[model samples]
Target: MTVRAVRRTSLVEQAVTELRRLVEGGEWPVGSRLPGEVELSRLLGVGRSTSREAVRALIAAGQLHSRQGLGTFVASIAPVTDFDRQLRRAELAHIYEVRVALEVEAGRLAALRRTRADISALRDALAAREQARGAAELVDVDLEFHRAVVTAAHNPVLTDLFATFLDAVRDASTEMVADQGPSPEDHKHDAHAALVQAIEDSDPQAAMAATRHNVEHTLAQLRPERP
Candidate 1:
């Protein structure tokens, strides 16, 4: 297991924060250059080195950029919103509910009618996931597997509904995988293999059970633990 590092704040951080506010507050307008080093130092009442460090900090923070001779300018006036702030608990709750409803039906249909080509696609997806280089690649291939399941069901509405939540679903999966850390993520593949076998045998009840089990287990993993 890896231990996360404890970080110590530095004066450069304060400089970065102050400079960010100055630019974001429109004291330095978008596309407008800041005063030269000497002038900025006089205005901010800081030494040349301190002002330079502050400027560099702002650049790294995405607030400003410096040209060799043209000097530092505000890059943009875009307002940044944290995704964490916008994400609602209820929305996440509903995502799982929707998954359970859609996937159970998809699993049933996949068992009844999955073609040889459909089985091949699912196998390819699992293979790609097994060979995934990083969390991003794993998430991509994992999504492909789920999408293949939906597609194999031969229901256009189910496929379209799954596509609608694809982005958020990807984000949620990425977050969980990152928190859980690394593959072979402990029997997850086994669960998928069971579902595949059910589908191959054309056993609707068994396929539905396997799909529901996987989704419910994912929901449990997503819940916060009590202290």
Candidate 2:
């Protein structure tokens, strides 16, 4: 085999690549502060300007964020693209619309493919939801129940995409509990029980219906005047 000539990268580009590696490898986790420009320049054996350029590039890419006096910190290993930022800023109702789409499919697939362990996890989550006494706890437990359902579907890509909306979903759940006062009409434990039973029995149509009812009930409560 003939040896090919290796292409050379600029110092700033190499620094960017190295910094990205450290962040992605968990050497620098989110919210962890990165070294100052002087120290980074020394460590990376580059000029301070090069280090600054690399850091600025990462900040623009959303991998790092700089505070006025607090220094630079890792924002996310997975850079927040424009599309992701838009999703993060979306209204709760719009977020839930996407959630309903994801979960309806997740429920259907879970009913068809869930293992005994998945069923057990779902049961545990629902039991925890029943026992939750406070709004915060109830919201958490409810999300856990839904998360278990998605996980049971055994699709990694779907699971990851669903996870990205979890914070928004949790916020919406908390708002629902706070506004509706956690009554039977608000929490809808009976509907949740029906969903668990449907999943346990491996009934796809029942599972989808139950999931849709849960989503639509919350949407109706949130937007009662919607036609």
The collision pairs in model 1 are none
lDDT of each: 0.71, 0.80
Per-residue lDDT of candidate 1, residues 100-154 (tens digit): 8888999999989899998888788767766766555666677787788899999
Off by over 4 Å in 1: 1-90, 179-187, 224-227
**Where does candidate 2 clash, by residue pair?**
none
* Tens digit per residue, CA lDDT, model 2, 54-148: 77667656688767557889999977776754444345567778888999999999999999999999999988988876555666678899999
The C-alpha RMSD of each candidate to the native structure, in angstroms, is: 12.8, 17.3
Candidate number with greatest lDDT: 2
Off by over 4 Å in 2: 1-90, 224-227
Query: Backbone collision count in every prediction?
Result: 0, 0
